[model samples]
Target: MKTTAKILNGLLILFLLVSCEKDELESTDPNLLNSANSEASENFNNGMIKSYSSDVVIQWNELLSQSIDNRLPQPAEVKIYVMVTLAMHDALNNVVPKYETYALDNSEVDASDITKKNIHTIADAAVSKAARDMMAQVFPPSTATADALLNSILSNIEDSDLKTRGIAIGQEATAAILQKRSGDFPLAFAGYPLYTEPGEYRSDFMPWAMANPPVWPANAVYAPNLGSLTPFGIESGDQFRDQAPFPLNSADYIKDYNEVKMLGCTSCPARTEEQTEIGAFYIENTSSFNNRVARALIVQKKLDGWEAARLIGLIEMSQMDSYIASFDGKYHFNLWRPITAVRLGDSDGIDETTGDASWTPTFTTPPTPEYPSTHSYNGGAAAAVFRAYFNTDHCDLDLISPYNLPGTTRHLSSFSQMARDNALSRIYIGYHFRNAIVVGERQGGELGKYVFENNLREIKKLK
Candidate 1:
């Protein structure tokens, strides 16, 4: 009886996929798999592929930005982005075999039955379904929006059989990734221990927290358990952890201390106007900014669907692992932010340093351990992936700051230059010492290179 029921259920699903009209299936259940509106034409080309993939990625990224703006944990944001991209890549790959998949196995998605003529149309449907399902699963609040987006895309695909098969493949990819990442939620924040010793991290009073009591709680450390979360591509979170931050009373510490103290202050005379602008420009949410840059490059470079999927998958996965590695080192070292260090400089018994209780940073310091700057780390990882993917660091790219100075734009000539600017921004903003930025960028670069070389390689076709 159980075997008969299972077979009947399978037949019912097949019937829905093959026989039911698109509107009928959608009306039968609003929860059914749907499509997003893509600007892709039937003619396959780099530009068309960009239209197909970029629309899905960019929309989801907007959702991610909204979540971040609403104060979702950083780790959770990265995890969701990684999952969605991976699902999209795997689903597309399943339809049109190109690169090896990140999560889905060969047996799970057979593409031998798909003909070359129908590949692009079918792949677009698969990618849309995969992205929608993964986003809805990982970030539940975006379900309605995701569904609407999917419906818009699916409504445009006229072929019912192709769309149905694509949806099935996408659903299979989503199920694989969901199962792979089970139990991988960001751990609850149970509050970190307070330390009073010099060079140790301590939570500071946040005026913003007072302004919004519910979202920004007083003295809250941001995602202390982030390091413990599972990485998407890397072996483990600590695989690329940096060494401990500079010790107090050391020359390196003294040099970094004085640099930030003189320049990071809101009223510091040593800081130039350009430095201030640079600091403010890069202060937007890192993930959002990086994704925008990547998407622009994807369009500019004229990447096909396979290429775009691999590039984005690499960037997101590398950044995710970089965050994990940086967070691991952050909690392990438990170093104080520059604000804390400057306020209690003299207490560290370092004669070269002077305490300034009235010191204020140009920006509110992030509530996390300062060692191995996560922002710089993500920048380095992202730059590394870009450089590797393009086979060079040079590119004509322009980006606008999303926060601090919203309309300000910066043109960059190379990926490495952007990474360097990101590292320096941490110092100019007075959030991190120079040592942390340096080490963080280095660690991130290593992790990014590792992820690119190791994961999602192009499949070698036999003659």
Candidate 2:
């Protein structure tokens, strides 16, 4: 009896350790999709079916990382979807006539006349096409799905600033440019420019990158593998494990220094006060997590065909618009994070504090100004969108993150609590201030409200 009991207890312990951890995600059965199908949900379901065809989730995350680096943010594929749906919705909202046009240039309205709303239309069309192209790229033409894709995009847009502002301008612009006899707005806008010169945006990165490119310190132990089977460069798999359990590319001290390699050292740098703050901001936000548990989670409601596309498109537009606003504020305040300010306590001429020679940030510092936490705003906007879809922010769900971690999963009963948790994680990870996170959360909630309410002038409120 004693021998049997010991074996059973050992077996139970092993089972407990392995069973609760998730590995492969179970694929949802197409035949067994959502069962509680109201008209709106049915609409969402149809769009989700369309969306399911594409691998938008993966691509979208990858695209967002190109600018601001973080474990979470809005996906690009959804953003494009919202752009398209907003275009269709904007078309419906066009109630104005031509003569109210403000000419952007005297250059000539020859074959094609340009207007703001028309330009917006052109961008939306481009987004849809890009999304479709990406979808087709992944699945063969016949397998490309739009059901989930549409629902996801619509949910985002219906709750985002992009749909509201883009559509706001689109509605007014559509009416103004549709004056009597020109397809000019539609035509000219199909390829209207949305980007400013790289010179302008790169100021934030150019100096940072120039001073830092890929480098190897004199004390490094890496050596090239002569064999073709191995990567010509870095060690792979278990060989590099003992020194560091995570990826060499994982956010680390050296990686932090490399971020501002482009910018030269200051010889009494004229902007000591400004540069140090920005440097500190960079140092604080650039950490990378392969996997980390998240308190807030995402719940996607399915919408169908045209409406799904439009609604999901609105969600993305809302996020993008919020980001633009957020980005604008980042540039506006030009503030510094606590890490840098705290570290350089003596340099700033403050006598009360001392720099910790061994101090390090918990996570990587993202490369942007810090005022409003993007994570907070994005989380709040997303939470509201989900609530709008469900008509309540009370769904209990688990969020399994793809931050490259082996097993990052979190669960919550209500969407709002999850949003709060996601916002609070910044403090847990120590990258943002409580004030910034709260402000971001407040702004995001407002942004979500503005996005949904903006579309309701023509109909009864959805929720």
TM-score of each: 0.83, 0.43
Candidate 1 residue pairs that clash: 35-150, 35-153, 35-154, 36-150, 36-153, 37-153
**Model 1 Cα shift for residue 190 (angstroms):** 3.1
Count of clashes, each model: 6, 68
For candidate 2, which ten residues in a row score worst on lDDT?
Answer: 184-193
* Candidate 1 lDDT, 11-104, residue by residue in tens: 9998887766765655664333321221121233333344444555555556555654325555666677788888988987787656678878
Q: Which prediction has the highest TM-score against the true structure?
A: 1
Q: Which stretches of candidate 1 lie over 4 Å from their true place?
A: 1-71, 107-109, 204-219, 461-463
Give candidate 1's error at residue 33 in angstroms: 42
Residue 374, model 2: Cα distance from true site in angstroms: 1.6
Report every candidate's CA lDDT: 0.78, 0.38
Residue 303 in candidate 1 has what lDDT?
69
